[model samples]
Target chain A: MARSPFNADEAREAWRRYVSTGAVARRLLRRSTYHAWARCHDLGASPHLLKAEALSVSDTERLLAEQREFIAAATPFMAALSRAASSDRHAAMLGDGRGVVLDVVGDEASVRGPEAVPGPGCLLAEETAGANGIGSPLAEQGYVEFVGPEHFIGGFHPFTCQGVPIHDPQGRTVGVISTSVRRPAASQRLRDILVCAANGIEAELLRLRLERDVERVLASGSGSSLAKLRDDVVQTYAAARVRLEAAARRGPAASEYTLALVREAQRTIERFRHRAALWRDLASDELGMRQPFRLDQRVVEIVDLLATDAATRRVALVASMLEEARVVADARAASREIFGAIVSALENAGEGGSVEIAIRLARRERRAVVSVSASPAPGVAPAGPLAAQLAYEAAP
Target chain B: MTRERSGPGPSSGRDAERTALQRRVLLVDDDDDFRASVAEVLRDEGWEVTTAHDGEEALALARALDEFVLLVDYRMPGLNGGEVFEQMRGRSPSRLPAVLMTASKHVADLAAHHGFRHHVGKPFSLDDLLGTLELALRGGEPGE
Candidate 1:
């Protein structure tokens, strides 16, 4: 319903626009320095500024067409993480070394539809550590622990971001895993958790490469001549590309598709490394506590049904373990309550080991002491002032 | 895994004493006829119902009564939904579940500022309102 006195009507058109999708206002978040770095007036380019443009001859459209398959799968995961970081209990952000966010994930709906991948969303977009953690950590080439009111973006004074550089097997920094938050001291856990996750993924990638190289050597036969085997090694390296081609059919940008391809390839390769997945499972439980009610066992089973093969199953298993973890958590809380009651009972028994009307009045106030009302009163005068003082001392 | 309240448990028969609370619900709207229309439907659903004309009167009743749940429109003449929520928050009974009716996101934004647990967007029906009430007031489990 329209609340403004000027509008004066609670029509459906007005209602639907204001109420759906958990969306936030975009006009409030338009403070980015991406404009300074862009070489031209390309609406498609947000944060990325291509430095060596002289290298590509395909022009903007054709060159972007080639990279579409890569961006489709990757952009949204980064986007989802951004949205997740936004809800963090601490100050967090998604930025490059250049400056604060020019645009954000939630409002990306406005930039919908198929488009070429621009340089704006890539790691090269990074610069120095500002108030935002992403740029700062990237600049430092290591983990940074930034606290509240220490940020460069004044509007983001409420947030703290901690990003770790995502390196490929070659130890070259390829991307970043950052936690954007609004609380103090959250940067450490978020930073370490993400860094560990990214490392696990990279380890899986390296393992897969190793596996493929070994298989090729065996396939070509170890008895082969040195010259022939050297050729085989190069061929295997080329064939075992870790970057999978995403469907340009979804219309993602070049860089976006490339990131997706890398992630998907890593997931496929990661299945061979069962230990890494288990570590991720444990981290998921530790870091993702603020998520609202989790999927039930049946829902987890439903997820199991939706996925096919090893990579999909890896995603689904995380959901199943979360369900199992909840059962243990609930039981622990109940046992704690039971332990409290048992301790109270033992303490009552320890004091004289008997109960009567005289003893009842002598017990502490508020701790109702039971006695036989039917029995004749005890002959002894109950323990008084000094005993009361002793009982008071032990009351806690 | 079950524990019975037989010996040394909380005092017996506390549940039976709480049954006499007013089951009637007073839902206020500028649309008195529409309010009555819904009241008749609620009567069919077996609830005694009452209606108020505006936010100011609604807030007064919400403070004075213990049993009824208020469903108020967001954009009303004197004291809008946000004003009503803030004043109600002052009263001990403000935690009582409220169903806010709004045709815009601004209603949600305002309700969020005042800590309303839930809201029903317009183009909704009496059924939607009832479901939200069962959820917020009854603590009914939402879809798993």
Candidate 2:
């Protein structure tokens, strides 16, 4: 075969420079050695990760196995976390603050990865380091780039990587898990995706720590005051569990390989306990919060509000609107509610959906800002601006 | 030039029949709906087609069948597309030239190692899928 015009090193370097301009990519270099090494490869900087780092091949292999084991344990929780991010393009990712990736899994390549890999496994160097989901989430943690010019590495450009750090029960960063390409998204959910995934890992740890007994106590307390108190605790626990599980499982498909999405959702919802306590404190100390409005007391009211048919429809409507405006159109609306929703969605996607929405004002659109984020949902087809651009004159 | 197989390989005076196997396919994807749709579309393009729901099933069917090439999806529930390719790679030289279906377009370098004719992505139209299929079918032979 004829050698290409540019040497491999130079080619990777140029692309690295280009990708570094992206919001998440530039910040990646700021992480610790382990994270930096992971980030380097996530950006397709394999040459540097392999050569510059003093870590031996054996270390890389060990690290890869560590990541694999971590992800395997967190799989169910991560899968649930990505479901939300996958559904709404406007959704943000849940992050544990390390790195965010979308649509690809990031991990050290195995020696055998150079040959051929089998079923749903992505090559991380030479050997298969990721089962589809982990690679994308790892990439989501640093930079969510799917096969395109925006991604620095041509080899992985076709695949999207969405990742985020997973946290242990006490919220310490443990490892990362992500989804890889089989799923694809158009833009801007990369960082957001990692955040969501990170949150998912945390939620999983918490669920494993606390959720199992929650259901039992609530059920046993079927009737009476003690039973009612137990029921209340269970309800709060269940809600928190739901959110935690969702955040973990609903991540990008690339990230959810061996896990189920519902598990993650339940995990996220389980955090209601902490939030509920915070609400109680706010009622007493904060001025805006109503007096005598104990969060535990308002649980019924809050549940009522959430359970209303209209509320459910509104959630869907909001999610769909986010998809149309932010996920598909790349337009950022300015309303506080819209902003909050978009931010939350981005956070959700970062948990593991392979979508990146990078927002800045559009090139020529007057007074309009484009969200600079990408959503990396595997198999989620990207929408085009062909029609939206044509409709711009009519976009009041 | 690569040597032709004695019997199962290309035959003498069978050069005219290149169009025959060239127009047939063995497609593998876990999604039955997707497989059916692909088969129908390929049939429309003057090709014969078969489908498999999982990687194991696809590999099992491939060994039993003759003449047709293959199209496999990288992400299935079990025995994914890559595993199927590895199995196919173990087969006799007379049978080869499988194309892969993956969303991992970034792994272009790795996918190239499978010795297949093409690696296409999912969510593609029948036209795009068939185009690559036709291209692979035209070059229905393996490389060293």
Candidate 3:
């Protein structure tokens, strides 16, 4: 049998009892709402608090500007969700992870009155607003529905609200989507719509992030790098297939080993994906022979890209660098040599080994010096016309 | 619960309908031969398969349909598997479990990063493919 709908009258009576006697009627409230109310009481929040805090006019405008991408990603979804809810007494809102309202749509009257509509810049974090839809989700980093009397503060008792936190690609809550209805008995349909909209908004945010990375690649002037990255992705699979076929030819004994080989190839591609942008940087250097760029940034980027590979090999790659260390040379030659030197060093270090990359400015020599050193060090010493670049020095 | 191919035919209309609904899936890949072959296998296994050649095409189908799992290739031109999965997830109103198909070595990490519970490596056996898909349908993690 389906569970009965939420009872606001029973919740109201329970809330009064809890506020006066510190006792909870668990059956009358959702566990999430009960916990949120407990947290509010622990923080010494007043049940009689009349309104939520609002930001100053300038602060509100600044917040609106700061959350531009978040609002832009969520606007269409919020509008659609609001339309689907299709109630004149319902309002949808978008709030930052900090519980500050960024955007609100639908019936403004739902949030109207002494508590404020939580339009732009209203700070509804649980400490201030007391277990509200917007603020509770941010605090708990999950979905929260505070229906009418479920709100710790009496001011919110006239409204039923549900909030769902939106997460970034890394799974951190970046913002929240919420719905508010004027009456206590909220429709379940509106809550479902809000949750779906939140998920969709997060997906859009990830797409936008990828777009920005693409723009960065174009801005870095590495069109060829995009092609190179694409080629790398294609070649990775082809190479894995070759390895598999070779292992198969070696007989049945190689089956287990072939799986390992495929696993390693998979890691290579994963690392490649992780450092796809860095590949673009390398491609940029592959252009313009006399172009002067910060050798420090280049070295740092290489280190960042190789860090995962190094971890897999059980070798630590550490770097010490001087800021703004510029080197004017065949940028491609400098980067290639530096990358080769580091790879050689990582190899020489062996398992449980360490390779240090240092970038220093030799003011007297008027050059930015880079050195890759390992315990045993690489076999071949630095011998190149790119002396203006750096040296592959051994650490004694 | 495993469904025996021998059980209830079209005569059992409700069971057939329920099974069909439960077995629906979207297969996205740029490789025509691979996609077609996999779709055939899945169809043979009693799955209702929808195929897309690219991310954009997959997104269009996803928007048009609902309540199906996604089996996507990690690499494809214009949007790739990761982007397509995310975009579809954003556009849909329900949880859509997915299984990744990739030739890359770090298949596990790639699948996890892209929010896929399971992955089938390239040059995989028929059993491996079906098993992974079943695991995803069950909402189980890779090992489980």
* Top model number, lDDT: 3
Model 2 residue runs over 4 Å out of place are A1-13, A16-73, A78-155, A182-200, A211-396, B1-144
lDDT of 3 at A343: 73
lDDT of 1 by residue, A335-392 (tens): 2222222223222323222211111222344221211111112453323211110011
The TM-scores that each candidate's chain B achieves against the reference are 0.71, 0.75, 0.83
The TM-score leader among the candidates is 3
RMSD per model, one decimal: 27.2, 22.4, 17.2
Tens digit per residue, CA lDDT, model 2, B77-111 = 54656778888878847757778875332335546
Q: Write model 2 residue lDDT over A1-396, tens digit each, in one string.
A: 222232334333444664465323323222222233345445455332211112355654554464564545445444443443454322222221222221122222211244111112223321123112233344434333332222333444334444444557565555555443323453333344445445545544553443334344345552122222222322333333333332333335434431332343334334434433332222222234212212122222223222211121222211111122222221211222222333344333332242223223243552233232334345643332211111111122
Model 3 chain B: weakest 10-residue lDDT segment is: B1-10
Q: State the displacement of the C-alpha of residue A297, model 1, in Å, after optimal TM-score superposition.
A: 42
User: Which order, best to worst by lDDT?
Assistant: 3, 2, 1
Model 2 quality (TM-score): 0.29
Per model, how much of the real contact set is kept? 0.00, 0.00, 0.02
- Kindly report the TM-score of the first chain in candidate 1: 0.31
Interface RMSD of 2: 19.7
Order of quality (DockQ): 3, 2, 1
> How many pairs collide in each candidate, listed in order?
32, 171, 7
Q: Cα lDDT of model 3 overall?
A: 0.66
